[model samples]
Target: MPRSTHRAAPTPPGGLSRRTPDAAVPLRPLGRLHDVASALTALLASDLKEHGLTAPAFHILAVLRRAGPDHRLTTGRLAAIDMVTCSGMTVRADKLEKSGLVVRERDENDRRVVHLRLTERGLRLTDRVLAGLHAREARLTAGFDADELRALAGLADRLERALQHSAGAFRPVPPPH
Candidate 1:
């Protein structure tokens, strides 16, 4: 009798193993992206804490500071941007006001309407926070060239837009007054 030989089958070009469960087929890339985002968020959260600001507070301050002094967003709008309830927005505004970082002004025509503005102290703090974050981001991306960064950013943008098209995508909620 002639000698018999046997060989194992090879995985395909994309590395999708035949042994993997059907449910995990498309989760690898998405899961990896989530992990990367979580890591970056943790780094940012630590930086924010070191500056005596929570992530939400820092985000709200940055948004207001970025808006020019002439025009301020209404509290409702801020709540929407923050994706929090109206009452939640008030709590944030209260904390910021106590810190002298933000001010609430009532509309002359409509006393019911209120707008949030950043104070000089808030502006200065936001600037410092931004600088630290930029430095941190630079450190994180030190290995990547501009082209690679752009490509990654482009991918993120596309993914974000696609997610937004879905009904379950998060939309900012108005804060409680």
Candidate 2:
């Protein structure tokens, strides 16, 4: 007889496969969550394109705008908040500085550190962009009633916390320094 190539699914001691019917149910919502996230990201990118800003650059401006009336943050802090490398933040800062959107100032007490402060032009632009994004988001959720929106937001927050907890298990070990 010819050798058989098919393999059977592995079953646990309880005689149930790891990929049980219950396991599949949770995945449907996860798939929908992915689609929603992707659509929102695309909308943001499209809006940013109209203002000649990449997502990261927009994020940098937004962070500074939220900092305070002075709209300042350290370059390193911006990198950490955006989860980008220092060099990457530097590149974004350089572009913003050249465009008159941000100014880089040396820390008074710590000469080694640099702070990025948004200029008047930068603040105005960030405000405009944020307003537009908020308006569009509101329109996107117009179909949902106030209570429904509140419930959805609460559920989303819970899902985010749950995912963060689960992600801890799969975090990769850091490379040796």
TM-score for all models, in order of appearance? 0.78, 0.78
lDDT of 1 by residue, 52-131 (tens): 89999998887787666643668888888887899999999999899998889998899999998888788888999999
The CA lDDT of each predicted structure is: 0.78, 0.81
Best candidate, TM-score-wise?
2
Question: What does candidate 2's lDDT look like per residue over 89-113, in tens digits?
Answer: 9999999999899999999999999
The lowest-lDDT stretch of 10 consecutive residues in candidate 1 is 18-27
What is the alpha-carbon lDDT for the whole of candidate 2? Answer: 0.81
Which candidate should be chosen as best, given lDDT against the real structure?
2
- Report the number of clashing residue pairs per model: 5, 0
Candidate 1 structure lDDT: 0.78
- Cα TM-score of candidate 1: 0.78
Candidate 2 has what TM-score?
0.78
